[model samples]
Target: MEPIDDLVGRLGRWSAGRGPLFLLLATRLRQLIDDGVLPPGALLPPDRRLAGALAVGRTTVVAAYDTLRQEGRVVRRQGSGTRVAPAVPTPGPRVAETSNPLFLHLLDAPDDVILLSCAAPLGPPPELTRAYATMTLPADDLGYHPAGLGALRTAIAGRYRSQGVATVPEQILVTTGAQQALSLLTRLLVAPGDGVLLEAPTYPGALDLFREASAGLLPVAVGPDGLDVDAALRLMERHRPVLAYVVSCYQNPTGAVLPPLKGRRLVERAAALGVPLVDDEVLADLTLPGGDGPAPSPLAAYEGGSGEGGVIGVGSLSKVVWGGLRVGWIRGPQPLIARLARLKAVHDLGSDVPAQLAAVRLLAGFAPVQAARTRALRTGHDHLRAELGRLLPSWTCPPAAGGQTLWVRLPYGDGVSFAQVALRHGVAVLPGRTMDALGGSGPYLRLHFLLGPEALTEAVRRLARAWEEYEPQPAAPHAVAPGAVPAIVV
Candidate 1:
């Protein structure tokens, strides 16, 4: 049973300027019932006790109870003071089934809608814009470079080298974006019905690509401590998957980083099991402003010592630079790079050369650009946390170490229903079910924190409104909710 005083305290902004305080209290109680905060069969305090707790007249409590009884929302027994009404059928469109999982759908959303679905950073680094402006394409006409431009490839490779990994341009393959690279690799590595191991709640786009390929999936749990190495090792041994994908740094949605020990163990185990590992470092550079020490090394760094030649590192400037740039590359053994490049050529001829030039310039100023992004993202994340705490205190959202989104668990309803409600309130959020490969993630929502503090504050306010509109009616607790490319440049 909820304490009367606590309920009274929660009446923020709901009781102001109300002519009938008893009616206002009744409305609040109804909402509480709807929100499942007060479950059915929950006994309410005695009218006199409640009045004393709320510092209101006993007549007000009696009036509120009488109103609830008249509406059949509550029943009063001789001994039992009051009990919530039984489940009632609610009529509405099924939001979960109709909700669009496609990220592109938000592109057409009205300007006023706050899109929390896609985690794309607000804007590109200013340096990237400047770079693109000053960049000059080669004099050669009708540039068709099947392999990426030589300059950008070398720059990407050089960064890998700086990380103590010996990489040459030949061992790199660039594509329109990381997604294309993923598709090409999936095509090359996974045949129809082949097993692929992935973290349970990983990138939705990756899951889409794998499903399109008709690959059998094996999911391992990724918790706050990161991926379970023992479970991963066991899965690899049993499934012997053709490819294993992981987000080792600043993982998507959850923002859980794989600790160094777990990372090393995973690489070693994968090598032992002969299962190739695809390490996604797309958001690797977006570490928070301060850290205990340097970020963990790429899982691919262990590939040299593993001697199995399985780790393929996929990096993108999308998070650190800009998503529209669509500049991403795969780093792996030269032989694998050559094969992927051949497949890539058959797909899109090559990535845009101008973007490649711009990426080269952006990398040249990587430090400053990344520092600025880190600062902005840190502020955005903190603001999001503060707003959630102040507005929707019941929702649980842990701070993300890094990454664009916060994976949140709702206090009462499931993510799909809440998302539908959120959309009607002009905020678009990605339901957690879309990210899970095995259909296990429900009751969760992935919220992006890339907006400015002001925007995030307003967005949370909208979310709170939606939360209020969400009738917690316990209707059967309607369960809520890479490759080395050796090819010449054109």
Candidate 2:
């Protein structure tokens, strides 16, 4: 095989007309493979060497590989690497309709790029070195452990108690990540046909996880205030949902924080309607400098003493600490925590032990992490908000009063198209559809203002380019032949 690094260097600086670098590469490659530009049994470039030459993370190359594998355009060998897969026959649809539309990479790193695509920004807390260096996993015989260790539970409980939550050590069960916490919760409570209330434009991964569990999603429109309680009440009363997952503080994509009263009221109403509330406090670590402290103790407090009313809280170190920490926990009824623990046992046995210790040690210093993030967000958002205001002044962007992102409506109102064009400009952005409840949108783009200073600026610039390129393009009907209708969206 040709040196893949050399190969990566040799490929022309490709245009990101439809999506970002990796996806554009994957899309073009998929088309070539289908057209036999690279025949079956032909080897594609290796990932590591390709990533090395591109100066992008290995994860980016991995995502390109994943997209190809998912599209059935490539089959990869472990030691031998990837090759063009044999093509299968398809429907005899018309020529125009037959062009394969590829799925973009869900998690891709870009080129010569400041990546604003990923949600995670900060690195491990400073103490992480001492935390890991001095900490020790047990010397016991190796085997599957139950849920989290007693030490972590105690530490987590103690941490929450400082916030006046008074969560019992026994009530907390650590999981690999908040995503798993959510998945386990769904497995325990939601069966097919069960209704789950999700804040519209909520966390996309959480939405995807819930959908995979086969639960029906009822979207409650979100605003700067928070989840619309009145609309949510209507949905709950009508659907009597089995679960209503929420992010009261710093709602994802929107950057909206729930007022103290709103958080309390959400708990009251959900309890009154017999719906269990899953509070996603993953982004609640208030880092947008000078923001208010956590809204009056979380909804879980209503069930605090005896653990009634069914308000479960989920948290993770991923956002505030580091995504690679792979550590998160839940606070609710000790009995319910026990139940999820059983569900967890079948999933990954237990949260990573080493990572968990690092987390416990890091929690004591959350103040510094929170302080650093607050400073960054405050500084970044000011520059970012100003840029948006000066550049695309027509749209309204809710001041990221305190979160990792800025949610803004585009002046022209087709965020999905602009996102596509941005990829072509060497930027990756998530469209509102990814955050949409039913895969549609409200002209929103979740702009992560928490990126490094240069990255944030470049990201906004790409947004401008994406908007410029996309707005004047004719609609699908005019772009393609009349009978060649645009494919149905999933």
Candidate 3:
């Protein structure tokens, strides 16, 4: 299984829309083995690891392995892991090779393949390296700060104060990243089966965490103007969700910044309904310079009268600094922060001390890093928009006001199928379905403009080739018979 684990993620694109997920995965594995792409006796990755990579439920991987065993295509030993059966019979008829984008991205591409999935900046700002050189941790002290280092906490609190929201060091709890902050909040605020509201196409990572908590979802649609204040109010009143999560600043997938008025109203309405709101600000400072002027104050700042609002804020250095820094903080009422810190301690004890020191240094000297990142993002945004217009004229790609991606709509064909074709052209793009909470992300795909101008040009060129070569999926048998009429199922 040395290299097989690396190959398991490639199965995702091919597994899309093809019967039962387990069967599709199993059949694809069989095809690879029969074609000698996976030679006889090749070891398979552990089911759990493969499941994590695919972003599928582990049970899917378990069932797939079971199906392969039943077909006599793979063998599972008591002590060792699964392996392809030796001298496998040839597959019947020549099944067409999978056109999955991930398959090609993983197995076919060379070192220079373009990336459109990740929105992370390439590296930390130069100031970070210098900051690390001058910063130091206490040599004699044991390094455990569950609520984060005092200096870092003070620095982060100062950021909130600068934004008009008065915060103290005690109100901030640092976690490994914004993801961990979400996890901690989910566990603290949501009970199993509790109703949770979110935007229709919010951050997929947040959706995954809520799903993992078994929270019932109430999705409100978001348009180009960001979360609809009216729709959010309606959903809040109707569903009575226990908690609602929103990305008010430079929202993900859509790259739509919430209008200040709408953001204020949404927070007020949620507070009126007694539902707590979590505002993810990981992409807050990434506002494209000169476009929106400046990012509006966080939703929590809208709390008027009596000082207590339902809003809780989460911030991270990952998007503004480098993702590798692994520094993020949760800002909420002191009581919530205390409870969350207890839960966070149980989860991982504490985040890295050195990274926290680095973050503190970066925050102290953030002006230059912010300028550099803004320049990079603005360049990427312009290049991507220009290329899409030149190469994909029929496709509608809205210009991003801020944030790292352009949410594009295809004039024809499904994003899933188009993604498979794109993979073959040496470009990898995420289909829209991955971002949908209610599985309504049809006809859309998200493309990150984080790459440089040259790579963006080449990537779009590859995408155009893929678009030309893409064939519409053949109609499935379930659609209709020759003269049969459709009937509604009750």
Candidate 4:
């Protein structure tokens, strides 16, 4: 988008509420061109001239034009102004292999589109952003740092301490992202064919990683109460998996929090069986409440100094500040962290020094990022829960005490197909199978309320529309209307 004179004035005159003017122009204009308002071979106004007409930044005009060209909404010949395209190619899912397009597709979607796909914080707090921008020098300000700085290690450990888990900085190895941390741990701890116990609807990509390691994946049941503790224990004892990865707080698919009681029980049981607990507290910012009551600290806390080992807690700043800020770390026994650090060096030398600096700034400036996350996600969450309760009474959402999304079990629908339908309806939804280690969601969908009215509601409504289409029976006769019960065929 280029600078244009009176850009603000034009937008004020023509634009409506809460949308990027440039984006709106691009969208509406593309629709116009498609409808033949601007016939093929018709010239578009020059960027600067158009900016004057719309009273928007010339950059906005340039962007609108660029998008038009990119999407084949228009064509430009050398020495000629842009011309309407004969046809426009509708945008479709871009499945990129080299880089994860799942993340990128998110960026491409409309800002108002609900983002249930990624477990991301709604947005960083102002204090956090300020702190990140004001990070100090000398710790290699612009240098590359693979292992997070000693300061961050101390701060992260301090964070866990308040939650009653005392850990040493040396016991924490910071990586680029929590996903990266998990990847490194898998490489270091899991050997091909090693048994790995995971929650059935566990983190989806993790299954892929464990598979790549050739680990024999085992699924343990997790119900509305969270992880089926006894079931998990049995699986752990039976398989003696090389890694027993579980999300302790605000679990991904279920938004299940492992309360303190269950956390202790799980740790003790795992220790008794000699199974490592790779606890991912990635979304454990105490940001969302759980249906089962208060959230628990890391399961590793239950380990204490029992010297049993095998309890490692993984987390990162991506959820708190920005996903672009690729800084994740693991806290466990010092020896294990050191080993993980060694493992981290293999893929990439280190995290960006600037990012580490920003993280440090974030930690110091804000009392705790968790505090800010809680405040930010609350309103959106309440609205989402309320709307769902009213519109989809059959859907089960077990009141997440804290997390970014609600794990919803559709009473009579398959999550996978619903998600596919959501895409066609212009909403983004992640089904249970994709998130599960086992390929079944049992009619579940993860609804992210963090995006708020900006996107969440529309997406949910779109999902509701999809649901409406899925109902098998047509409208019943007057006897079967709202107040009356129909005859039961069975």
Could you tell me every candidate's TM-score relative to the true structure? Answer: 0.75, 0.73, 0.75, 0.71
The per-model lDDT (C-alpha) reads: 0.75, 0.68, 0.75, 0.66
- Candidate 2 per-residue lDDT over residues 1-490, each given as its tens digit: 5345323422333332434667756654553343232446668777877777777777877888899898777888798788877645455521322231212233333345544555775576666767888987778836354568777888888877776676778889898888788878988998755678888778876765665554556767787688888778877886688889988877887877777777777788888888999998887775466555544456676554555457888998877767778888888877888899988887778877888778877876777866776777688888888888876777778676566777777765455666667778877666665565433343566777766667677777877777677778743110111111111111
| Most lDDT-accurate candidate | 3
Pairwise TM-score winner, candidates 2 and 3: 3
The most accurate candidate by TM-score is 1
Q: What lDDT does model 3 reach?
A: 0.75
For candidate 4, the lDDT comes to 0.66
Off by over 4 Å in 2: 1-108, 112-114, 141-144, 292-296, 438-440, 474-490
- Where does candidate 1 stray beyond 4 Å? 1-104, 305-308, 475-490
Model 4, position 137, has a per-residue lDDT of: 69
Model 4 TM-score (2 dp): 0.71
Candidate 3 residue lDDT tens string, 141-207: 6898889999999999899888888788998999998988998998888765577888867787787
Give the Å shift of residue 466 in candidate 1: 0.9
Give the Cα error of residue 396 in candidate 2, in Å: 2.7
TM-score of 3: 0.75
